[model samples]
Every structure is written in C-alpha cells, then in structure tokens.
Target: MRTAVCSGSFDPITLGHLDIIRRTAACFEQVWVCVSPNAEKKNQMFTPEQKLLLVKAAVAEYPNVRAELWPGLLADYAMDHGACAIVRGVRNATDWDVERELARINADLHPGLDTMLLPAAAEYEHFSSSMVREMIRYGQPLEKYLPAAAVELVRKMRTELNREEA
Candidate 1:
C-alpha cells in the first residue's frame, strides 16, 4: 500500500488544511492526518488530543484517511508506518520554503521517502490555523473557515477556554 503522512500542528483544522488532506488522500492508498506536537508552538488554541478529535471529525468521510497524534521527526513516523511519502500543503512562498527544507531533511533521514506538496485551493489560500484561532478569539463565525463537521467543536472549545480565562 502506498501510504502518505500529512502532518501539521492543526491547532484547529482549517479548510485549507482539509483541501490538502483530501487531495493527498485521493492519491495515496492511505493517508495519516497527524496532529504534530511541536514543542516550539507554546500557545496552542486546542490541545493535541482536541486537535486529533477535530481532525478525526473533519476527515470522517475519507475511508482511507485516519487522524492521530505524533511528535518528533515526521519522516521517521512515516517510515515506521510504512508510508513512503510526506504530504504537505504549500499555500505561499514561505510555506513552500519551509516544506522544501523539511523535505530535504526527510530525504536525508530516509532516502526513499518522498515529499508531495499540494497547492491550497484559491478560496482557502489565505486561510491558516493562526487565522482561525484569531477568528475564534474574536468570536467570529467559523462557517467560512473551518470544515463543517468541526466548526461546532472548535467554537465550543474556544468559548469554553475563553470563559475559563474570564
């Protein structure tokens, strides 16, 4: 089976992220939508467990797609799972550069591992996890940004978190 790992922080999965995941799923026999746990990301709107739940809800329709949490080298995780490719979303030049460098590192870590970059759909090109968090913080409606299945959970979580802070 040709498997691919689509790893990201996914504090709250955005439409842009879903677009990339859907595209990747169509290409690979199985795709893992991994909620990457990055120590550098100190301020996360949602916990890793929450992100995993949201990702699971968002990708429920894709029979071949599974959502989970992973920390450390993404390529190594892929290898352990028998995945041959690391799929990522490239929304702009900055994202492209970062993914490109990571691709290089992944290749070095495992020579046969391939990296596939999918362009964000035009409508979701400007959407990002940070932007979604900002919208949630300001109490903006998420219908346009978040995947339909996860909108309610994200909104509810943000509201609950905000209440706790109050």
Candidate 2:
C-alpha cells in the first residue's frame, strides 16, 4: 500500500485541514493524519487528547484516513510507518516558505521519504487552526470554519471551558 503521512498540530481540526486530508486520501491508499506537537506554538486551546478527538471527528468520513497522536519527529513517524511521502498543505506564500524549509529538513532526516505540498482549495485558503482559535475566543460562529463533524465537539468544549471560567 502507498501510504502518506500528514502531520500537523491540529489544536482543533479546521475545515481546511480536512480538505487537505481528503485530497491526500484520494492519492494514497493509506493516509495517516498525525497530530504532532508544535513547540513554537504556546497557549494551545486544546490538549493533545482533545486535538486527537477533534481530528478523528473531522476525518471520520475518509475510510483511508486515520488520525493519531505522534509525539516524535515527523520524519521518524513517516519512516516508521513506511510512508512513501509526507503530505503538507500550502495556503499562501508564507505557508509555502515555511513548508518548503520543513520539507528540506524532513528530506534530510529521511532520505527515502518525499514531501508533497498540496495547495489549499480556494474556499479554504484563508482558514487555519490559529484563526479558528481566535474566533472561538471572541465568541464567533464556527460553522463555516470547522468541519460539520467537529463543530459540535468544539462547541461542547467551549461550553465546558466557559463553565470552568465562570
């Protein structure tokens, strides 16, 4: 089976992330949506477990896709899983710059693994997890930004957080 690994922090899986996963699933027989940590990103709204739950819910429709937590290096994860490629989503020039460098590093770490950058679809080009988090903090509607499968879970989590804060 041709497997591809798609790694991201996914603090709360957004529709854009789902779109990329769907596209990747079509190209590869097996796709692993690895929810990895980002040391650079602090004050994450969701825990790793919460993130995994959100990812699972967001990707439930894709039979070829599996969501899981990955604590180690992404290159290592790809190598361990025997992934032929590491799939990444590119939304804009800034994303391109960052993903390009990461791809180079991953290539260095796992010479056999190739990186495939899929450009975001027009509707999802502007959506990102960080933006979703900001919307949540400000009490904005999330129906448009998040996947239908994950919107309710995110709303439930928000309600729980509100109760805790109150």
Candidate 3:
C-alpha cells in the first residue's frame, strides 16, 4: 500500500487541515494524520490527547485515514509506518518556504521518504489553527472554521475553558 504521513500540531483540527487530509487520502491508499507536538508553541488550548480526539473526529469520514499521537520525530514515524511520502499543506509563500526547509530536513533524516506539498484550496487558504484558537478565545462561532464533527467538541472545550477562567 502507498502510505503517506501528515503530521501537525492540530490543537483543534480545522476545516483546512481536513481539506489537506482529504486530498492526501485520495492520492495514497493509507494516510496517517499524526498529531505531533510543536515544542516552540506554548499555552496550547488543547492537550495532545485532546488534539488526537479532535483529529479523530475531523477525519472520521475518510475510511483510509487514521489519526495518531506521535511524540517522536516525524521522520521516525514515517519510517516505522512504511510511509512513502510526507504530505504537507501549503497556504502561501511563507508556508512553502517553511515546508520546503522541513522537507529538506526530512529528506536528510529519511532518504527514501518524499515530501508532497498540496496547496490549500481557495476557501481554506486563510484558515489556520492559531486563528481558530483566537476565535475560540473571543467566543466566536467556530462552525465555519472547524469540521462539522469537531465543532461541538471545540464548543465544549471552550465552555470548560470559560469555566476555568471564571
């Protein structure tokens, strides 16, 4: 089977992330949506476990897609899973530059693994996890930003956060 690994710190899986996963699923027989941590990011709204749950919910519609929590190096995960490629979503030039460098690093780590960059669809080009978090903080509706399956969970999480702050 041609497997692809899509790794991200999906604190709360957004529609844009889903879009990339859906596209990747179409190209690969098996796709792993790995919810890994970003060491540089702090004050995360959702824990890794929560992120895993959200990712699971967001990707439930894709029969060939599975969500996993991988704390180690992405290259290691890809290697262990027998992935042929690492799929990444590029929304703009900045994303391209960053993903390109990361792809180079991954190639260094796993010579056999290739990185596939998919440009975001027009509707989802502006969607980002950070932006979704900001919207959650301000009590903005998330129906449009998050996948239908994940919106309720995010709302519940938002309520819990509100209760904690009160």
Candidate 4:
C-alpha cells in the first residue's frame, strides 16, 4: 500500500492542517500525521504527545490515517515508517520556497521518496497553527481556523497560561 507522511510540528493541529490532511488522504492509500519533533520548538507549548493526542482526536474517523511522533531528520523518519511520499501544505510563495528546499534535501537523502505540496484551501488559505496560537493568545476567536476539539484545547491552554501568569 502507498503511504504518505504528512508531518509537521502540529503545535495544536489547526483546521488548516486538517484541511490538507483530508484532501491529501484522497490521493494516498494511507497518510501518517507525523508529529515532527523540531529542536527549534523544543520548549514548545504543546509536547509531542499532546500534539499527537490532538491529531488523533481530529483524525479519529479516518481509518487510513494515523498519528505518530518522530524526532530527527524527517526524511529518515519517513523512510523508517515506509512512507513513499511526503505530503506538505503550502500557503504562499515563502512556503513554496521552504518546501522546495526541504523537498530537494529529502529527495537527495532518500531517492525513493517524493514530496507533494498542496496549496491551502481558499477559505483557510491564510491560516496557520502559529497564527491560530497567536490569535488565541491575544484572546481572538479562531472558530474558523481551528476545529471544535482544538478550540476547547486552546481555551484550556489559555486558562492554564493565565494561571501561570497570575
């Protein structure tokens, strides 16, 4: 069976991420929502487990979709997981540039793997996990940018952050 790894930090697994996953699922036999473990976000708000939990909850209905965490080189992880393709979501020119570079490196590292970039849906074309976090941090509603489960998680996280602040 063809498998694609749609990996990302998934800090909170926003609606934009789901949009890509749902669309990409149609093209691949199986899609793994890999919870990317990046050193840059080591001290992140959400732990990898938390991120995986969120992703699992969000994709519970999709029998072909599974969520897991992987730390280190993405290409290496995809190879280990038997993913023949990497599904990425691109929102703009900058994302295109970044994904292109990543694709080049991944392809060089794993000759058998391919990378596919899907542009974000029009309504959520501008949405991002970071943007969703920023909006929630500033007390802005993100009903459109986040799923219902994510909305609850964001609210809980906000309360926790407020408690820590106070």
Candidate 5:
C-alpha cells in the first residue's frame, strides 16, 4: 500500500488542515494525520490529546485516514509507519519556503522518503490554526474556517482559556 504521513502540530484542526488531509487520503492508500508536539512552540492553544481528538472527529468520514500522536522526528514517524511520502499543505509563499526546506531535511533524514506539497484550496488559502486561535481569543466566530465537529471543541477550549486568564 502507498501510505503517506501528514504530520503537523494541529493546535486546532482548521478547515485548511482538513482539506490537505482529504486530498492526501484521496491520493494515497492510507494517510496518517499525525498531531505532533513542538517543544519550541510555546503558544499552543490545545493539548496534544485535544488535538488528536479534534483530528479524529474531523477525519471520521475518511475511512482510510487515521490520526496519530507522533512524538519523535517526522522522518522517524514516517519510517515507523511504512510511509512512502510525507504530505504537506502549502498555503502561500512562506509555507512553500518552509515546507520545501523541511522536506529537504526529511529526505536527508530518510533517503528514500518523498514529500508531496498540496496547495490549499482557494477558499481556505487564508485560514490557519494560529489565525483561528487569535479569532477565538478575541471572540470571533469560527464556523466558516473549521468543520462543524471542531467548532464546539474550539469554543470550549476558548472558554477554558478565557477562564485560565481570568
């Protein structure tokens, strides 16, 4: 089977992330939506477990797509999962540059691993998890940028965040 690993922090799974996951699922026999933790990233809005739950809910319709929590290097995760390629979503120039470099690094880490960059759908080109977190922090509606199943979880997290700050 041609398996692909799509790993990301997924602090909150936006529609943009779901778009990439769905496209990857269509292209590969199986796609693993990995919710990875970034020790360098200190601005996380959700826990890894929360992120995993959100991913599971978002990808429930795609039988071939499975969500996992990966704690090691992405290349290692891909190798462990028997993935032939890594699927990345590029939304703009910045994403392209970063992902391209990361892909190169992944290739270096695992000689035969391929990286596929999937462009974001035009409608979701402007959406991102960080932006959604900002919206939630300031009380903005998220229905348009996230799947219906995820909206509630985001709202609940936002409320908890508000309480924490209070």
Candidate 6:
C-alpha cells in the first residue's frame, strides 16, 4: 500500500493545508498527518498535542487518513510511521526551490523513501501558518483560509488574552 505522511507544525491548520491533505489523500492508499513540533519556533500559539488534536478533528471524515504527533527528525518520523513517501506542499517558487533540495537530501539519506511536493491550490498559494497567526493577532477575517472551528478557537484565545491584559 502507498502510505504517505504529511508533516507540519500545523499551529492551526488552514484550509490551504486541508486542500493539500485531501488532494493527496485521494492519490495515496493512506495518508498520515504528522504534527511536527518545532522546538526552534517560539511564537507558537498552540501546543503540539493541541495541534495533533486539531488535525485529528479536521481529518476525521477521511477513513484513510490518520493523525499523529512527530517530535523528532522528519524523515525518521516518516520512515518510522511506515510512510513510503512524504507529501509536502509548495506555495511558490522559493518554497519549491527549498523543498526540492530537502527532498533530494532526504531521499539520499532514507534511500527507501521519497518526497512529493504538491502544488498549493490557487486560492491557498499565499496562506501560511505565520499569516494565520498574524491575522488572528490583528483581528482580520480569516474564514476564507480557515475553518469555523479554528477561527472560533483563535477568537476565544484572543479574547482571553485581552482579558488577561485588562
């Protein structure tokens, strides 16, 4: 079976991320979303466990899709999870250039695994986790890029933060 893993920090998954996951899910026999916790990232709004929960909830409709937490090396996470390939999304030329090199190096190191870059949907080409956080921070509408549930969480969190400040 062709098992592919989609790994990302998924601070709060956006519709763009959802688009890639759904599209890739149709192609692979099974698709696993690995919530990668980036220790180097300090501005995270949600914990890794929270990210995993959100991913699991978002992907519950797809029986062929499963969500899990990945805390270490990405290639190792893919291999350990029985993923024959890693499905990555590219939003622009720069993203492709960077991801392409990483893919080549990952293949060389893993030998048995491969990486596939899925182009972002037209509307989602500019959607990003950092952008989502910024939107939430600035109180901009984000229904187009995120689901209602995620927006609600952002709203609640923002309100609570405001209360704390007050």
The TM-score values for the models, in the order shown, are 0.95, 0.96, 0.96, 0.90, 0.93, 0.89
Q: Give the Cα-based TM-score of candidate 1 against the true structure.
A: 0.95
lDDT comparing candidate 6 with the true structure: 0.85
lDDT of model 4 at position 159: 90
The parts of candidate 3 lying over 4 Å away from their true place are none
User: What C-alpha lDDT, on a 0 to 100 scale, does residue 96 get in candidate 2?
Assistant: 94
Lowest lDDT 10-mer window, candidate 1?
34-43
- After best superposition, candidate 5 residue 151: deviation in angstroms? 0.9
Residues 84-158 of candidate 2: C-alpha lDDT, one tens digit per residue: 999999999999999999999999987878999999999999998889999989989899999898888988998
Please give the ranking of all candidate structures by lDDT, highest first, separated by commas: 3, 2, 5, 1, 6, 4
- Candidate 1 per-residue lDDT, tens place, 20-125, comes to 9999999999998878888887668788899999999999999999988887678879998899999998889999999999899999999999998888899999
Local accuracy of candidate 3 as per-residue lDDT tens digits, 1-166: 9999998999788899999999999999999999999999887889899899999998988999998999999999999999999999999999999999999999999898999999999999999899999998888988999999999998887788779999
Residue pairs in candidate 3 whose N, alpha carbon or C atoms collide under 3 angstroms = none
The positional error of residue 125 in candidate 5, measured at the CA in angstroms, is 1.2
Candidate 5 lDDT over 29-142, as tens digits, reads: 999888999998778989999899989999999999999998899999999999999999999999999999999999999999999998999999998888988887788888
Candidate 3 matches the true fold with a TM-score of: 0.96
What global local distance difference test value does model 2 have? 0.91
| Model 2, residue pairs in steric clash | none
Cα lDDT tens digits, model 4, 33-117, are 8898777764366777778888898888788898888877889988987999999999999999999999999999999799999
Summed backbone clashes in each candidate are 0, 0, 0, 0, 0, 0
TM-score-wise, the better of 1 and 4 is 1
Q: Which pairs clash in the backbone of model 1?
A: none
